[model samples]
Target: MSSRDPAPTVSADEGVPAAAGEPSSAAPVEPAPVDVPAPPEPHRSRAAARTWALPVGVGVLVAALFTLYSLAQWRAYVVKSWDLGIFTQLAQRYAALEAPVVHIKGPEYNLLGDHFHPLLVLLGPVYAAFPDAFTLLVVQNVLFGVAAAVVTWAAVPLLGRVVGALVGVAFGLSWGLQHAVDAQFHEIAFAVPLLAISLAAALRERWRTAAVAAALLVLVKEDLGLTTAVLGVVLAWRARRPALLWLTAWGVGGFLVATRVVLPLLNPDGEWAYGSRLDLVAALSDPVGLYDPAKGYTLWLLVVVTGAIALRSPFVLVAGPTLAWRFLSEESGYWAPTWHYSAVLLPVAYLAMLDGIDRARRGRVRWLRRYSRYAPVVGLTASLMLLPQLPLWQLTNPGLHFAGLRAQAARDAMAVVPDGAVVETDVGLMSYLVGRTDVYYLGNDNPVPEYLLIDRQGGGVPQEWGDVLQVAQILHPGVPFEVLHARDGYEVARPLED
Candidate 1:
């Protein structure tokens, strides 16, 4: 009786049949199919707009501050005549659509031959419009700021919002980047952003964009080719893409050609003057121990400031060759944080730090996970503490205050020297006279200038009245030249003929 006992019971009002073993009222009802369209794909542009809003805002703020600070430095006449002057001269020639010849380096030294930096050609258009040292400074600051923005954008996905913002801030305010800005113009300014974009693109698995970005770094500086090569290696390893490996060869080959073939061909001496520093063994074996302890301390601080997490990522290897090259150089200048050499390293360091943070968050490393959570705070605090040590601190000091009277005096003296005249002057005055005249450093070789200018009260290479007389007599013997104008410690002397 129990085997055949189950039967469906029908409802009095509804027509739908119930299951064979269930009562009609107790059966489950199927819902009618409703046409619900998938939520319109989140507007990509709007989503991107939200994603980039914070980083762009932060980048603009940093860039504005840096630009104002740099402009102040320019107005105060704090910029030196060496690099700033040399680059200005090159840019001026580029603006005029002429070969980028810099007389400040020599009588007519082609800048491209000296450094193989074709990237500087881009500045020609900017300087063509603005045509001043201040314009160059502004361009550099803006590019660096953009680079920071790119870093922030990259870090956000890996480290979350807060840590990502810290990475951007730390990178923007890094002593190396600030020092490069303070030191005036450098080819590395372009390299910084390009490298940041390349790393970010690689992390996002945008292989073609990454390759393009990495390849362009070669034009920024010859040595940066090595960094690009490392980027290729990292991309190939992570994505298991063989075609991208060609970038590695491109970078290595570009570096060799620039240094060995192109540079020598362009050099007047038939050899790259900077080649002496390439001997790693010699640099490592410094007998005088001139490598300052301060430099070592700076190196340590750079590493520690990254929360020591950068070392965990393979991307950190991108910095290895640069660090090695710089540390191995016999030049003490290369060892210090005072110059722009470390500017390119900042992007690499911060990107690697973000990668490490991502890895820790995904893994079971307790201490790393804990540290990663607070890394932004740690990085920001470190940056603020080190702020005073940067050139930016000079902004608050009175020493950099712009002196209108002194500036006028210098300008007036430069005005007296006719355009196209060959002039020899000290570092402080060289930048002012570059584009208007054929300018040369006071002590470089046997520079016989049609005019001799100097600031008797200027803060540059010490020039006594006797030193000018001595140089004039040695170079232009028996050619009588008289002071055209002398006032406010600024003097211009010209040949009687001119």
Candidate 2:
């Protein structure tokens, strides 16, 4: 994910401990004594270049494909939620080197209070150069792409070139990633690539790289601190890195401060709103009730996607925090394999599949070895078969990038509102205008906007508020508004006095 950081080196086999008689678990990181000796220096350089090229090429391709749909969504105005607008506004503030004040959230709301993501400040420069919501989507896809490349890098030595590249492509196109790309830009996008690099580095026994990646994850999202802690625990137990103990402490401490101090202090409510989700006492009292069918279905899909192979590696424990919080939370949205929720788990599952393959190949059980031998193909096949119904399917359509009549109408509505004016908007037209306007959600309480843009049939509009005038009156009680333009259920308005 780093411009300076080279991709994971494709040397050494990531192997498990040889049955009870094997020389220690660390025996695997070393290349098996090559009796054939080293290749000629000239040839070795070429071979190394080619070896690295394959994964790099695949990563770039995967990233392009993922970005394809992202651009399509942005171009077509296929916003799934207000999150796109929220991030766009946040990025604009950061670009101007201002506090993360997001008017889409509210006129005075600092987004750090919504979630402690100081890492997003990095987006300021990127957004400054590109200055569009699509930039966020591209950044997100490229991160996912890097993860895919890392997975391919780790898999190549384990599974060989053909199957390894297939697995990498599969990981990129996996249901979880596709769903996330389909859902659009989010802060969680950063976590996906970091998890992949950390797991891949761990697989190759690169403890330093693993530590760095895991540390970066804590900054991506507050909840991911637990994931980092769990990764450290697994690494410490797997090997004797004394530094890992400190890594564990770093993770635990980061989570505590992010939730208990940073988030609450930034939040207007003076509390991390999501802190309520961590009620261990409630979870303990009714552990059985937490076993809802939707959660089970989510678990089932995770297993099925990996063909049950991801369960073999203890590194899969990295997904524990991700799963634990989801199951612990009352939000049913978290329990399902929908949106960007499960994006972090994709890299963990695919890399763990590689780890699982190692253990399976070494196990005494013949059936297990055979299953491990084919797990990559099994996963790839499963992903390919499901691709048609996934977001990538849009890539095959003729109109994939077309901004339809409704999209044009939205662009028009947003065009009517001058840049930098305070504007209240519903979901459909909100993100399009956010790049320039001080956008507020239409129904929310805030300083009255100079303009109002509404999509009468927009996803978030209250169904009972059918009349356009009625909506404006509710937004600014005593003020009168004149409809400047209305087309295809999209409306742009201004105060009668303006």
The lDDT per prediction is 0.80, 0.84
User: TM-scores of the models, in the given order?
Assistant: 0.86, 0.88
Instruction: Write candidate 2's Cα lDDT for 380-449 as tens digits.
Output: 7777788887778867883744555487777777778888898888888777787877889875687767
Clashing pairs in 1: none
Against the true structure, what is every candidate's RMSD? Answer: 7.4, 13.7
Which segments of model 2 are wrong by more than 4 Å?
Answer: 1-48, 398-403
Give the C-alpha lDDT of model 2: 0.84
Give candidate 1's TM-score: 0.86
Backbone collision tally, model 1: 0
TM-score, candidate number 2: 0.88
Give residue 143's error in model 1 in angstroms: 0.7
Q: What's the residue-level lDDT of 301 in candidate 1?
A: 67
What candidate 1 gets wrong by more than 4 Å, as runs, is: 1-41, 284-292, 398-405, 445-448, 457-468
